[model samples]
Target: MSEPLLSIHDFSVTYDVDPPVHAVKGVTLELARGEILGLAGESGCGKTTLAYGVQRLLKAPAVITNGSVMFHDASGEDVDINALGAEEMRRFRWDKISMVFQGAMNSLNPVAQIGSQLEDVFEVHRPEMTPRQRRSEVADLLELVRVGAQRARSFPHELSGGMRQRVMIAMALALRPQLMVMDEPTTALDVLVQREIIRQISQLRHEFGFSVIFITHDLPLLLEITDRIAIMREGEIVEVGRAEQIWTDPQDAYTRTLLSSFPRLTGERGVVVR
Candidate 1:
């Protein structure tokens, strides 16, 4: 197997409150380079919290009390991301790793043109690029997500839900980060739109060779796209296995229950395990 591109060793998180709420337990996981790993769990299961912790996006009242996040970059240098300083982390965020926030379609600025929003990423990360270069880059990015260049002049409110989500994805990929952390990237879209966005992500992954840590509660979608699945519950990962093994022979009762919660498209309920 290839060396782990990202490693979590006994990581834990807590929210400050009366007696404190443990949002994540000691969870050790690994992601190989260019692999799509799914984090499956219901809401409040610490899936997002874990992703936030890895990216050092946790704000006040939430603390990482234990463990470390080791990120091995393409240059073969490994660094404990949790230990980086503010300046170092600023450089690390988009250049080496980028995150697509939950409900990201709604995260775009309604007042700004889509092309301007896309250009902002380059402005902040690649300031050396001239104005003409940034505009050209923005056009290329729009084409990459299959959003035609004509829509670049349109505002966020002018695009459909899936197109907006694609714009968000284009911005995240602008820096060409080694790892992309997608937190419920397909949420709120209709079934068909969700499928299209998922398909686009898979194709982009194949073409770009970037790894993804895809977080979502949708088990069926994860099984369809991810190479491996990690089942999380109550802030803990209960089972981790390959997609086929997880679907056919879940090792945990919770995993089985999760699989049973989703109705299959062929009018079969138990076929995932068959």
Candidate 2:
């Protein structure tokens, strides 16, 4: 195992609505170097909230009420992300940690070419690089994510959903971040394409050595790709265990319901469809 990279110590979140809703409730988790930790829960269960909060992306209405999210830098310093100011977080956001968000395709500039948009990352974080160097790195990133280098010149509108997602993955990896937060990475992708992306990401994690926080709703899919899983419900993590162990022996009723929900193509559920 590699060094401990990030720690979320008993984190909880609350929304400051008319009647405040607690989203994340005392959730404690950690990720080691090169590890993949999956956050599994249904919609509105705060999986994405936790991921975005770790990256300091929460808005005004939503507030982190308790706990600390510490980022262990490559220099061996522990930086508390929640305590940082706006400018400080700007320095850390994409350079040390990155996110491949659910709406990442639309996050790209509609008017800009894909490679030029990717160059913005380099421009902000790696300003020393010339335009030529930035373009070279963008091409390399495309290849790293198993996409053709030529697609870099095209705008986001020209690409399919899978292709756009692949571009987002490439952009996330461009900085060679030590940790990445991915929420429903293959959300709009076909099952086959989703599998391909998952396989590539797992391979890249092995090759490049970055810890991943994977958020998704598919248990069978998560079972196939993740190292560990934190099964969550109504804003709480009920069980945590190794992926294989959880798949075989889930400790929570919510976890069991989720496991049973997977449509096994050859099982009883399949009989109805076939």
Candidate 3:
């Protein structure tokens, strides 16, 4: 197999506080080119924290105790991302790697139009593009994410939650990043809308050709989309394997129990009733 595009080795993060919360504990994972790896876990289990750790985007009081996140660039440079300076990281954030935050519907500016918000991504990362080029790029991005170009003129509040999420995906794709991190990309929406967004995300990945780290707590949904799944608990990974394999034969007790909790309709072993 080709070398993974991103590798997190022995990564751990601890927050500096009175009790010193340990968010992630020695977690290691990899994402190869065009691969989709889902990080599934309950809240407080460190999935989001680990995403922040990989990009070195953790805020103050969050300390990386040990280990490193290495990004293997297309040019064959293995960049130790943990050591990247803020300026380099700023450059890397969009062009090299992009992240789609949970509740990205709320992330868009209330005052700004969707086109302007998408333009902001292009502005920050591709500042040299002419105004015409920027508009073309923004329009194209909106189309790519399955949002009508007309919606670009609308505000985030004017659109539905799913549309806003698609806009976020469009913004994340503006740079054609090699890796995209999605944390709970489809939470809080009704079932139909969530399914629509997830389907769109999968289709867009096929169209754009980028690796994705899709994080969510929903096991049934994650199983449908991701190639591989990493099951986490208590700040550590309990299992990591292909979706079908884990669904059929989870070796870890915790993983099996979690599977039991999410019984799929077109079911197999994991979804089997007691």
Best-performing candidate as measured by TM-score: 1
Most lDDT-accurate candidate? 1
Report the C-alpha displacement of residue 274, candidate 1, in angstroms: 24
Q: By summed lDDT, which 10 consecutive residues of candidate 1 come out lowest?
A: 265-274
TM-score of 3: 0.94
> Clash pairs of candidate 3?
none
- Per-prediction count of colliding residue pairs? 0, 0, 0
| lDDT assessment of candidate 2 | 0.88
Ranking by TM-score: 1, 2, 3
The lDDT for every candidate, in the order shown, is 0.92, 0.88, 0.88
Give the per-residue lDDT digits (tens) of candidate 2, residues 243-270.
9999888889889999888778566755
Put down candidate 3 lDDT per residue, 1-274, tens digits, no spaces. 4568998999999998989999999998888888999999999999999998898889889999988899999898999998889899989987889999988888899999999888887787888988789999999888887788888799888988888888998988889899999998888789999888888878877887789999999998888899999999988999999999988898999998887887557757644446
Q: What is the TM-score of each predicted model, taking all chains together?
A: 0.96, 0.95, 0.94
lDDT of 2 at 17: 97
Number of backbone clashes in candidate 2? 0
TM-score of structure candidate 2: 0.95
Shift in Å, residue 241, candidate 3: 0.6
